[model samples]
Target chain A: MTQHTQPSAKALVPFVSVDNMMRLIHHVGLEQMLRDLAGYVEDDFKRWELFDKTPRVASHSDVGVIELMPTSDGESYGFKYVNGHPKNTSEGLQTVTAFGLLADVYTGYPVLLTEMTILTALRTAATSAMVAKYLAPKGATTMAMIGNGAQSEFQSLAMKAICGITSVRLYDKDPAATAKCAANLAGTGLNVVICTSPEQAIEGAQILTTCTADKQSATILSDNMVGAGVHINAIGGDCPGKTELAAGILSRSDVFVEFPPQTRVEGEIQQMPEDFPVTELWQVITGAKTGRSSAEQITLFDSVGFAIEDFSALRYVRDHIKGSDFFFELDMLADPDDPRDLFGMVQRAAR
Target chain B: MTQHTQPSAKALVPFVSVDNMMRLIHHVGLEQMLRDLAGYVEDDFKRWELFDKTPRVASHSDVGVIELMPTSDGESYGFKYVNGHPKNTSEGLQTVTAFGLLADVYTGYPVLLTEMTILTALRTAATSAMVAKYLAPKGATTMAMIGNGAQSEFQSLAMKAICGITSVRLYDKDPAATAKCAANLAGTGLNVVICTSPEQAIEGAQILTTCTADKQSATILSDNMVGAGVHINAIGGDCPGKTELAAGILSRSDVFVEFPPQTRVEGEIQQMPEDFPVTELWQVITGAKTGRSSAEQITLFDSVGFAIEDFSALRYVRDHIKGSDFFFELDMLADPDDPRDLFGMVQRAAR
Candidate 1:
């Protein structure tokens, strides 16, 4: 066999670290990045029919669940490895952690690998706000954040950037969490209000986002507390039996979801019967279905988080990191001079 | 809100690169590593009922298929991302490439991440040899390796290490591939012979291993080519519509498989009926099923490669990387002082 003189290609995959993710978010201001991510997600949702869709493959344990969400757009493939363990926070660890990769479909080589815990937060918020862009009442300026945990500030900023919201009311079962969220959003140019009760928080709000971190079904928002013409972004009801809104709220609202098959199993719809009617969010984004039919119509965005959002987020990071110091190359693949001579390469490496 | 003085404990994941994988293999001699990996795989198989089992999630395109194989053993979870594009070799790329991760099932923190392109080759060969040790006829020595591509030398070395094979005869449709395998195994202390045809390669050989890399079901070995008292290792027929041996051979031999659900779809047994009797190799390992029934029996180990093997390989690597420079830490998770204050963590990082 002829030997090539070039050094091993040793396929290098660009890796975005947690620190660099923060740097990238800061480089592009937080609100603008949220807006930019919303655009990418909207573009993908508009072309959602072209994507390979599958419910996340999950391994559930007694205490937590780890899932692999994979999707492809014919040209590129992406997947996120994420886990949800609400008890982790009590043990001094994040309740949710994630990382993802984008690979070329043709060559099957990974192009980007990134920490997705921060990005997931951004994309989830952006997705909620993007849906609200179509579903929320016109001139909506205030949002009631019922669970001021990790996602409260991001959801607020995204709504502000995407839907022109100017203020947010934060409330949580734990006052410390509410204080931390209000403190974090102090300088984000949005009016931050610390509400003593969920009902008080939603008193004059046009949007209500529920993002509590718990593994059980809890009535974070009751039906009586919800008013008409308000868009409810339900994010915490992501897994089976872990819903935040009362069933009466979903019964009265024209619910929308990312993917029905997943939402039926994981989202707030899990509380309803299998025949529960929900609009595919893509259809609403594509204008095939009406988002908010009238000023007094109730709209709820039941988000379980789909793979395409992560795919779009990965694509955004892949595109933005070119020639930037926000990423470093990882020598991750064995690219032998002769692709068929992997053994020979290993033998020579002994020298 | 009070801020903690400690640094963010963003979960650090350890990564093993291609270069580091090679170093690790050499640090522990190649043969010993194969033997050690086989032991881990065998140990896992013995307790296979305790594992979380599912068929691989695959996305197939016209050119290739990318798959995510995940499995958990209650304590740790492991998954491999692998792709196979047969035409990739003609374009000077590997026909297969892979990487994998192992994570803690408790906290969902990634424990180890490593490039599995090289490791897959090693683990595949080890798994084949380990199965051969159980089913090969007594006193088996010489083995015939048709389709001498990337996996040929490793299979030969692993057979020598685990199954006590002393010599190998190699043949490929492309003589250049045969020559490359022969040259690579020159100083490996095992006798290697280059043959012009599959017929000549199997002469006087007790084990027949076929690993041709084609996407279609082409017969590399006809039924007449097989004799009694031999163990056949079939590796290339790992996807639907891809098979190496003639159907007559499968009908005549006692078949053993790993994960029947996956093997029946991807292995050579796809040619057989749904009820075709095949022994699960794990059952044989645990003494629940017979391996080699008699000296005159023909046994075929239909090895389609399963998630459990990858899990075991990952477990072995995770155990062996302790106090070794073969890995580096990756800051892959976002850990905040207040777990719910991820937004605050990013805000603080801007300073």
Candidate 2:
């Protein structure tokens, strides 16, 4: 009964807390971290065909939705548990929160657990910027950052770091949100401008990113406001009945999506018909399909987040956390000395 | 930028480690905890109509399978991440490992995270015994426990605690497994009999519980071994292509199942036709259907563990952890004083 008290090393899973994740970001430097994450996202996108992909399993309620997004690349499996409650901000809670796990496919053991609320923001921005690198017009230097909420700063910084953007035009329906974003980007070396309307935000910007937090289908961008020869990163509308771009804008733009099945249901393309012509970003990354063929062609990355992005982010964190103090091990799994004697382990723990 | 260093209390989730879970089991007393867990399982089953049920999302490889089981009763949401690798035991790892999370349905915020490896074993036994109370022959006292693995001792103790079982006859193909189960039950009050064959194990027993760990269909119980009035609690055949009872035996018994959609794919009934008649255990608990209509009827509970039972176990752990130090808080969620200023929160952490 008294044989074993402590679980073996295999029982422990490395866990990255929010504070530690923030520390890791700072230790690596924010912009550099964003670049590294973008690199991982790009690498995984190149091998996208080798992975197992599924549309997120979602539980929708009147107030919000909780979703499980799982994917595996034959060697490793990853899943993210995330919740989106637009009304939660009024109650002093974040609008979205997330955590993710990576497991070994062969042993079916979780190797890493991490706080993904911050990481999701990083990955989403990284993904957008990475896609824009291929789809954006050459010599792009300015980005119109509409919907200056939690994701605004990340998108702005990622563009500056990855896409050589030197200026960001910020606008949101809520002035306070724009102000918060403006303050966060004050010393980030980007030319941050506060605009009152979406039209003013997109003026002279080569890239336009829409990232509002509304739950309904309010068009943040109309067709009349958009000009050709620009890359549009629309990330705000990520669920059914929620969209940022008008149907006219979608028709004018050649849409790019992470995954078509998921994009059709939750992305800006949800406004379009089910059979809407769209390019998969992975195909573009693999050079099987062209990203942007002409300077006057409108390219829109309909950024509904996908499971593979999270898997890539998880892999990046798992790799970076090694030989570093950014995470602590959690005694999460039960390990018995005798695999078949789990009852004996519990019985001995009593002593 | 230096305003907030630590996350707000809302961002912290209480996490129960494996050690703490074992401590909790001893604190509540093993028998009493099993009884309490069975009570919760019964209560949830009684109101199962209110729950959002889904078949587990599974990721399968050549070696093993990892599954996510999620369910919500509208007020609270729960999900368990579990893996089953039959070959893991040969490599000195557990055949199964699990962890779970419970969140608030209103805010979509996780409230509790706990190791479900041990909890799964407990809840599974509790659920079997609870159902056996209704379907097992009235005044049943002896259980024939075939396949003495990690789950055998828990099943034996749970039946003793909940169903008033007085004796257990144990048998396994491996003598070491049978010996391990017998040794773990030495101090338990039930009269334990070690049998060399499955036929000898069922001698004079009213309940037969088969819990082998094979990943394929292996008939531990045949039609000829069963008598007219005995109850079968077959819990081993819990995945695709895995069944413990012979089809002939299934044809001779009235099968009861938890979540017919799942049981049809993973339970002993996978051997039968899709249209095979089986009673939903929830309906029996809610008095919508009859259970064990007569003393001479052969009742079979094809026990493929369901999400609702895991939900009940999560609820029990959450309730019991209150006012106790059985868990520690993990900084899992991102919290900001200004919820719209998540970037500001990360920026401030740099200080």
Worst 10 residues of 1 chain B by lDDT: B1-10
Q: For each candidate, what is the lDDT?
A: 0.93, 0.94
Candidate 1 regions exceeding 4 Å error are A1-10, B1-10
Write candidate 1's Cα lDDT for B93-211 as tens digits: 88999999999999998999999999999999999999999999989999999998999999999999999999999999999998899999998989998899899999999999999
Q: Put down candidate 1 lDDT per residue, A183-295, tens digits, no spaces.
A: 88887799999999998999899999999978999999998999788999999999997999999999999999999999999999999999999999999889898888899
Error of 1 at B38 (Å): 0.6
lDDT of 2 by residue, A1-351 (tens): 222368789999999999999989888998998999999999999999999999999999999999999999999999999999999988888889999999999999999999999999999999999999999999999999998888999999999999999999999998988888999999889999999999999999999999988899998888899988999999999999999888998899898999899999999888778898999999999999999999999999999899999999999999999989889999999999999999989988987
Candidate 2 residue pairs in clash (backbone atoms < 3 Å): none
- The model with the greatest DockQ is 2
Q: Each predicted complex: what DockQ?
A: 0.62, 0.71
* Candidate 2 docking class: medium
